[model samples]
Target: MNKQQLQQQIEQVYLDILIELNLEKVDTYFAPDYVQVTDHITTDINEFKAHLEKLKAVVKSLTIETFKDMLIDEEKQTVFLRYDVIVEKKDNSIGNIEVYAVFTFNDDGKVIACNELTKEYDEQVKGLGSI
Candidate 1:
């Protein structure tokens, strides 16, 4: 796909999946064999879905505080993204995290793999990225 298409897809995923926690749209953006490595911990599609479910249960809202960068390599079907997230829990607690991620899209435009690193903007809120 071209750069604009890739950018739109990624942006939509962030909105529908990460911010909205719409689990039904997971398959639309991710391949069946999707795999992810977050903060050196690896997880497959099932694990990723579970993580989203957990977030959906505890998170009241999630916002992308900043989109620092998005670099796409269309020929290689890869994109790099750097962003900050602000997550508010149901109990009114907030956590901020900064993330840098690289995603690889399959021929069908589904994400096949992702490698990412996240740093807590404040004290160590464990598993803020993958949780």
Candidate 2:
């Protein structure tokens, strides 16, 4: 596929992953040896899925913004997306957050690696620190 097509595919995969959390069509969207780079460290695909499971407990719902700004690298099969997100909590509270992600895809159009950046959109309510 072309660069734009590859990027769009990865972006759609991510949207599905986040909205559904803890469960994903990994084989369809990612290589078995997928890796992820985060603000803290890098890990394999399984590790990333486990991390998502943990995150799901805290974030009930997610809304992504600025999808049109996504960048793609077809030659290397990479995609970069910078977005804002609204997260819903168990208590019906909501927080806005900013996140950036880089994705690398395999020849099959499956994501093989990813790098993600995240930050709270505002100071945490009740002095919890941040979103």
Best by TM-score: 1
Give the CA lDDT, 0 to 100, for residue 82 in model 2. 83
Query: What would the per-residue lDDT of candidate 1 be over residues 80-126, giving only the tens digit for each residue?
Result: 99998887888888888889999999999999999999998765355
Which residue pairs in model 2 clash with each other? none
Q: Clash totals for all models, in order?
A: 0, 0
Q: How well does each candidate superpose onto the true structure, as a TM-score?
A: 0.95, 0.83
Model 2 C-alpha RMSD vs. true structure (Å) is 3.4
In angstroms, the error of model 2 at 131 is 12
What is the clash tally of candidate 2? 0
Tens digits of per-residue lDDT for model 2 on 41-110? 7788777777667667776787776574688877888888888777777767888767788888778888
Q: Model 2, which residues run further than 4 Å from truth?
A: 123-131
Model 2 weakest 10-residue run by lDDT: 122-131
Give the Å error, residue 99, model 1: 0.2
lDDT of each: 0.91, 0.71
